[model samples]
Target: MYSPALQPLFQSLLSTLADLNLAYDRDREKLSESMKDANLRTRALEKLKQQHHERREPYLQQLAILQDRIQRGWH
Candidate 1:
C-alpha cells in the first residue's frame, strides 16, 4: 500500500537485499572449500613428516655405530 512514488524505491531495496544474500552465500561456499583444501594439505604434510622421520632412523643407527667405533680407537 505504498504511494506510487515510493513503490519503485521499495522494489529497488528488495532487489539489492536479494543480491547481497546471493553474494554472501557464494562467499560462504568458497570459504568452506578453502577450509577443506587446507585440511588436505595439513594431512599430506603430516604424512610426509612421518615418512621423513622413519627414513632417518637407519641413518641414525649407522652414525651411532660409527661414533662407538671412533671412541674405541677401532677406526
Candidate 2:
C-alpha cells in the first residue's frame, strides 16, 4: 500500500520507465534495421568485387558509417 502523496510519484516513475522501455525498443529496432542494411550492402559489394574486380572502398565506408551510427545510438 502506498500513501496518497506518494501515489503520484510512483505513477510518474512508472510512466518514465515505460517511456524508456519504448525508446529502448525503438532504438533496438533501428539498430537491427541498420545492421540488416549494412549486411545487404556488404554482400552486394562483395558480389561487385568478385564480378567486376573493383575496389569496395565506398561500400566499406558506408558500412563503417552505419556501424558507427549504430554504436552511437543514433536512433
- Write one digit per residue (lDDT tens) for candidate 2, span 23-60: 65565555555655777757655554464323334444
Write one digit per residue (lDDT tens) for candidate 1, span 1-75: 334554454465556556655765565555555656777757655665566556555555655664565567652
Off by over 4 Å in 2: 37-75
The candidate 1 region of ten consecutive residues with least summed lDDT is 1-10
Residue 26 miss distance in model 1 (angstroms): 35
Error of 2 at 9 (Å): 0.2
Report clash pairs, candidate 1: none
Candidates in order have lDDT scores of 0.57, 0.54
* TM-score between candidate 1 and the true structure: 0.48
Q: TM-scores across all candidates?
A: 0.48, 0.46
